[model samples]
Target: MLKFVLKRLLHMIPLLLGVSLLTFLLMSLAPGDYFTTLLQNPQISPDTVARLKAQFHLDQPWYVQYFYWFKSVLHGDFGYSMAYKIPATSLIFARLWNTFLLSFVAMIMAWAVAVPLGIWAAVKKDSWIDRACSLIAFVGLSVPDVLLSLLALWFAAATRWFPVGGAQSPYYDLLTPMQQFWDRVHYLILPALVLAASSLAGIMRQMRSNLLDTLRAEYVTAARARGLGEGWVIWKHALRNAINPLLTIFGYSLASLLSGAFIVENIMAWPGLGRLTMEAFFAKDSYLVVDSVVMATALLVMGNFIADLLLAWSDPRIRLK
Candidate 1:
């Protein structure tokens, strides 16, 4: 396991470098930049623009600028964010925690609801309950997150049951600790639900399929013939094998938890990396864009790595292979 992990970590170095280079090249290909936007303002003279470009090394060749940026990145300096007028690292870190919190909880909620529901649907296949689960899953899979977020906002507005947008109420700081916690949860519910809906639907469907296949295996029949309780056969034996595919899904979910939050976060006014990255993109903030992409790519690699570890742990055959 240690050897496998080390090998994966070694592989990520060049992978990250390739991602950063490709991301930088793509950003460079985009015509105009942060300074180009500033050029439109009649008050900002050409000399000022030239000086600013030079200061940021934007005046340098693309490769030269990339080298400097990469060097700085290695030293933990993510460069400056001209749009936000903050250090890129600072800006990203400030929002990182919030994005992490939102993504983690939403994914957990998704898997939590999906697993058992999936098992139940599989076990009671073709029944009314299965049909109901299928109907709900179809709705979840069909609805676009943006539309769902908008609808959630509308519901919050009409019913006043939840905060309409944002991560917390205005008086969050003044509230008692417990009140603050619930206030955060209240604000979190709509956006989290919006984010998790599609994921939950997909996971549930996958779980149902996997579990159904496992239940049909000869092992399950053998267990039944051995006088094992149906519950024991299903829960202890079938469930363990059925869940392997879901574990893989869980790993992929770790990566998407943030990237997938973009649309929902923007619509719901959640302060997270998704909204920040969008803002940076429109503003042509090179450092911010590159940093965000690199961060996301790192997450993707890490997610796969963790997934591999889980697979090896759960199935001894994996390690032997």
Candidate 2:
């Protein structure tokens, strides 16, 4: 298993290199250079531009620039953000953490709701409960995330059940530790629900289908014949087998949450990597763009790798190979 993990980690080297290289090239080829925005103002003179260019190594050949950037990357430097006037590493990591926090909460909420509901739907297949679940799931799958988030934002305004936007309440600074916790939760509700809703529905639908299928399997029949309680047969025998697939999809859902938190982050006014990426896009901060892409890709790759290991552990049929 250790060897398998090591091998997989080693294999990611080339994939990451390809990802970085492609992002670098594509970002470099973008229509505007990082300095274009700075130069747009007539107040900035040519000598200043020349000095800025020289300082950023913009005057150098692209190869030389890439070489320097690559060297810095090896030293854990993500380069400076020309727009922000700050080191990329300093700002990016904090925002990345915010993104992670939001996405992680969303994933937890999604699985929490999805697994039980899916199991119930499967257990009660062909009944009213199952039919109702299917209808909700279909609507969830059909609703656009942006539209859903917008509706949720409006609902928050009307219901006052949650903050319409932002990561924490204004009173957070004055709160006690326990109060702070509750405040953050209060602030997170609408955004987390908005983020989790569609994901939960999808997972529930998939799990329900898989569980229903598993219930019909020969193994399940054999378990039932052994005089096992219905609950034990379903939860232990059927669910264990059925949930393997959900385990795999859960990893994908995890990756999706981490990578696709943009809409939710924006809707919540969350200070996160997605917001930074949007800013970078507008500024054409090529290095920042490439760095953000690399970070997101790395997170996804790591998520999948962990998921694979988890799947292998959960089902002995899937070994390290």
Candidate 3:
């Protein structure tokens, strides 16, 4: 297990490098940069702009800049954020938690609802309950995240039930710890739901299919012949095998939630890494963009790695591989 983990970690290095290189190349193709807006200032001279570019290696060729940036990255420096005027790492870490919190809540919400609903639907296959779940899943799969976010905003606006945006109330600091927790959760409901909704349908459908297939397996029949209670046979035997595939999906879903958060965060004004990344991208903060992309790529790699570990642990056959 340790050897497998170390191998996966080693593989992540090249994957991250490739992602960073591609992001850097694409970012370079965009016109202008963080300094462009500064150039328009009447008080700032061309020499000042020149000095700024030189200081940040913006005047250098893309490869040269990437080399210097990569060197710093090797030493645990993520470079500076031109827009935020801070270390890129610090800026990213500051927003990282918010994104993680939102993604975590959304993941829990999705799986908590999806798994049970899927299992129940499969158990009652072809019944009204199954059909209803299918209809709901279809709607969830069909609706885009952007539209869902807009609808969530509208609902928040019209009903006044949930806070429309941000992660807490304005007076959050004054609240008691318990109140503060609930305050954050109150604000969390909308964006988290929006983020979870997009993935929930797919997971539910996958779970339903996997469970259905597992239930029909010869092993399930054998378990039944052994006189295992119906519930035990279904929940313990069938679910154990059925859920293995979803563990792989579970890993990808983390990265998916982060990517989806980019849009949901912006639309809902939720302060998170995604919103920060978007801001940096528009400002053409090259270092910040590279850093954000690297961070996201790391999350993706880690998610898959963790998933692989879970897959192996859950099924001994995989560990042998």
Q: Judged by lDDT, which candidate is best?
A: 3
TM-scores of the candidates are 0.95, 0.94, 0.95
Tens digit of per-residue lDDT, candidate 1, span 1-321? 677778899999999899889988888898887899788899999999999999899988778889999999889999999998989998888677677778878988998999989999999999998999999899998998878889989999999998877888898899999999999899888888878886888899999999999999999999999999999999988999998888888888776666678888898889888888889999989889888877777777887888888887887778722
Q: After superposition, how far is residue 28 of candidate 3 from its true place, in Å?
A: 1.3
Q: On residues 1-321, what C-alpha lDDT tens digit does candidate 3 reach at each position?
A: 678778888989889889999998999988887898988899999999999999999998888999999999889899999888989888888788898898889999999999999999999999999999999999999999999999999999999999888888999999999999999889998899999999899999999999999999999999999999999999999999999999999888887888899999999999998998899898899999888888878877787888888888898788622
Cα shift from native, residue 229, model 3 (Å):
1.8
Error of 2 at 36 (Å): 0.8
lDDT of each: 0.87, 0.83, 0.91
What lDDT is reached at residue 83 by model 2? 90
Between candidates 1 and 2, the one scoring higher on TM-score is: 1
Q: What TM-score would candidate 1 get against the native?
A: 0.95
lDDT of 2 at 144: 76
**Which sections of candidate 1 miss by over 4 Å?**
170-179
